[model samples]
Target: MTSVSLVAPGDAPLTLPVAAAPAPARVPTARRYLMCEPRHFAVEYRINPWMDPEQPVDVELAVRQWRELKGVYEALGHRVDVVEPAPGLPDMVFAANSGTVVGGRVLGSRFRAPQRAPEAEHFRRWFEANGYPGVVMPERINEAEGDFTWTGRYLLAGTGFRTDPAAHAEAQEALGVPVVSLRLVDPRYYHLDTALFVLAEDLVAYYPQAFSPGSREVLAGLFPDAVLADERDAACLGLNAVSDGRNVVLPLEARGLAAEVERRGFTAVPVDISELRKSGGGPKCCTLEIRD
Candidate 1:
């Protein structure tokens, strides 16, 4: 496989000052993640309501914030890897949309929008070159981590906005896991990551309003002790979070959700990535958990 540089010349190395926190007892820490530096990140297209091509972005701030997020994972002793950012593909910084990784196999994304289509190949190639050769390209339209997440045993998939429901069957076959499909009703919650989060095997935090009545019922049945996020936190993109069984890394603006997470015995670490939210992503969107 041909190697592609996953970073730019002036991009800062992954190393950063570590401020380690003691891991909570009985909780498993994430060991690996895939991230991309916001070297060429910008709001050049209006793909979502969050993006306004007319407005300008603070490129330097985006880079700084992205690095800080990477640092948080490193501080927690997780391995972070990069996929070189292609010049024209600014949205590539939202790495989670690339694909879903489970059991060392990557089911590549078939992007809904044309602007993000090229990113599928970039992520696929990165995984192929980085030792994960079981990369399955899906026949149906799906946006990997953006619409799919694992619950330690089963696969939770989201559709109705970017991913097609047909892709859920593909996921079941590709990952060899039972797949539960959830329908996203609101456009603001375009991706599943924006509405629901898998905090642990049996725990989840989500905004009920984002899903349809039936989908909401399915979630309720699946996770009886779900942490419900109020409108305030949901609007702030608080539900888009990454958890390591014990600790959840979320946006600082989501105070209500943070409090709820803490009440569940998990330490909530808040990191500000407001600049990246300008492109319709938060902490979870920037990091792709490499389960392999």
Candidate 2:
């Protein structure tokens, strides 16, 4: 398979300092995941920095890549559940934004962009149909797992872009888990999952420049040994990955970070979803882990 260019047109090259990842024994565990087919995926409108209408999108390619990602989960012995795609809701393929699931309860999404607002209802219906009842739809704008990512003991909630700070407290109250608010400084990494990812219960990986100084400090304190991504990987949305403790499946375009993950004692499984990346999403964007 041909890999997409290291950087897209109009994407200024970002070369920053890199750090070595310390490898440690991490056992893999099967997980239950929810994904949506990218049948209607397109770059019709620009809600984030990554979307450019001039950049052509291929729905067929997106579907194939999405299926490959789903297959990766299945091959890893994980259960993959699908939610039907609703036409006109192009971004529905990013199932992670549908909701934040912790302790088996769903915290529904409220999209900040009007174009994606309708997606919440469609996702909510899927949860209900799939036996997830009484899903808490927060009044404040929170893009579900896009902004709210659970890191074992606490939920690392993001703000300053799509999700509101108020939504952080709402999720904490609803999920009964402590929520730590991280302020995203860059539009490119608007979601918490985009900049920070939990690799295991005690380990994580992140792009430091994507977050504010205070937020970065908090992350340093929380996980001092977290794998830090260089600009090349972070630019390709490499930090947006799904890890099953021992295995990490991420965008193939983020090869630099993939190597880092492997050095950190995790098997890095890379898949190309360049078509989907045209809309600012990678592997983690398409996979939502249901913590039951």
Candidate 3:
């Protein structure tokens, strides 16, 4: 009965179907996640638009915020596993870029930036050392979970930024899953996870302006009722929020996004990870979902 205004890549308005399907049941399942301590976190170089070398970083505050984010997972009945943060590798704290894990198989990371390239090997070792079987590292550049998002059915792969187009095929081959490629044009929403994330198996929330016209149409067709975030939410890195189907954990500054999810029959749990965002990361960036 209610009208939903959907936006294409260029901010073109697209209305929802007159007769929409019934809302699905919201089920919160426990998750197993991998995170890195912000012990060595800092903004030494500018890789993304959110990063600024001029602005100083407070390691103490970053650690505190990161701890709080980890705490949020614990409170949600989710298992939080930590990988040691190596010295000199500052952005390692954003562990979600490490790689993708689905059905106990991993498609490892191959970073685009030289500054963050070493992070891939470090993450690869963690997977192999931690009982996760054969971790296949793609030769082509890919940011792993950062650009490849598992939507429970298909892998929404991203390109035109960090991940290379060839990596999508490698992921499909390595992980034995279907991948849908989405091109990102905006520098701010460099990673697909930053511009969009699955709220449930059949649903996702995204910022349309970050995608191309064709990619936006593909998303609109796939998720008709996907939550659309406003400029305010995107600015706060709100679409980077992580959802366990029922609980959505996002940045506290993402107030508009929190309200949107809450209205859509989901619990919005906001955390203050502002210190981490200084390096172009939020809740989802720091947390890597390990689906087994």
Q: Which candidate has the highest lDDT of all?
A: 3
Ranked by lDDT, top first? 3, 1, 2
Error of 3 at 218 (Å): 0.2
* Model 2 ranges off by over 4 Å: 1-22
Q: Model 3 over residues 192-242: C-alpha lDDT tens digits?
A: 989999999878999999999999999999999899998999988988889
lDDT of 1 by residue, 124-189 (tens): 999999998879999999999999989987899999989999999999999898999999989899
lDDT of 1: 0.90
TM-score of each: 0.90, 0.91, 0.92
Error of 2 at 77 (Å): 0.6
Clashes of 3: 0
lDDT tens digits by residue: candidate 2, 1-292: 2233355588976555545544568899889999999998888999999999898888888999898889999999999999999999899999999899999889999998998999999989988988889899989998988988888899999999999999999999899999999999999998888888999986899999999999999999999989999888899998999999999988888888888888778999998988898999999999888999
Q: TM-score ranking from best to worst?
A: 3, 2, 1
Model 3's alpha-carbon lDDT is 0.91
| Root-mean-square deviation of Cα positions for candidate 3 versus the true structure, in angstroms | 7.4
